[model samples]
Target: MGLNIKNETTHELVRRLAALTGQSQTSAVEDAVRRRLAELEQQQSADEEERRRRIRAVIRRAQQLPSTGRTTEEIMDELYDETGMPR
Candidate 1:
């Protein structure tokens, strides 16, 4: 229901935000905290963005690879028979 900010600088910043935005101090702090928490929980940081970029690049590269008309089973049939010995 309440928060106690002991730091004068932090208190002043909250007061400044409240005045500048015409919001209550609680609303200012709540907005700031909620935005940051959402970012943290949703992985909206730069590192997360870079990681997603890398994963996308990998997916793109994989999709660009040439496809073989033969399946793995077909290749195995060429290399080995029903007895599991090399042909």
Candidate 2:
């Protein structure tokens, strides 16, 4: 398989990487791609963890709120009026 790099800067970087690591151009490119993918995966995992933490905090706060003694039907009617829903 043949890989063609069109960007001059990218080509130069690949060439430098190959020389620095004592690897072929293809191996250097492959190693760079693999490292980038790993970094992206780590970042995504951290983002997911932060999202979960925020959700858990929201749930905890909601649980701490005082509960209204209204029945389900009464709550639904109140919400409908607040939203100006048609009868």
Candidate 3:
């Protein structure tokens, strides 16, 4: 397979990386891509963990509130009469 890298800067970077690492241009590109993908995946995993931590904190706070312990019908009685008309 062939890759078409039209950007001069990107082409130069790939060439430099290959020269520095003493590898072929294809190998340099492959290693760079893999390393970047690993970094992004790790970052995404950390973000997900932070999101879950926030959700758990919210749930814990909500649980600390007092419960009414009243059923829906019992509560509705406060707003409606026996004929189901609004009070």
Candidate 4:
């Protein structure tokens, strides 16, 4: 496949990377792209783990709350009575 880099800065970076790494420009770009993809994947995995941790923490907190064992209807009735609403 033909990879035509149009951006001047990107072209310069590719050239510099190739020179520094003693590799072809194509190889440099490919290596950079692969490394960035790996980094992004790792970041995404970390973000997912963090999300799961937060959800677990929330579940644990909710579990610690006292449960009256009252049914939904019973709770609503109590609230209505407190508000002086007619049953």
lDDT of 1: 0.92
**In candidate 2, which residue ranges exceed 4 Å CA deviation?**
81-87
By summed lDDT, the worst window of 10 consecutive residues in model 3 runs over 65-74
Each candidate's TM vs. the true structure? 0.49, 0.84, 0.78, 0.78
- Model 4 TM-score is 0.78
Per-residue C-alpha lDDT of model 2 across residues 3-62, encoded as one tens digit per residue: 777999999998999999999998999999999999999999999999999999999999
The lDDT per prediction is: 0.92, 0.92, 0.96, 0.93
Question: In candidate 3, which residue ranges exceed 4 Å CA deviation?
Answer: 72-87
Best by TM-score: 2
Regions of candidate 1 where Cα sits further than 4 Å from its true position: 44-87
> Which model scores highest in lDDT?
3
Candidate 3, residue 64: Cα displacement in angstroms equals: 0.7
Which clashing pairs does model 4 show? none
Per-residue CA lDDT of model 3 for 31-69, tens digit only, reads: 999999999999999999999999999999999988899
Give the per-residue lDDT of model 1 (tens digit) for 21-48.
9999999999999998998878767778
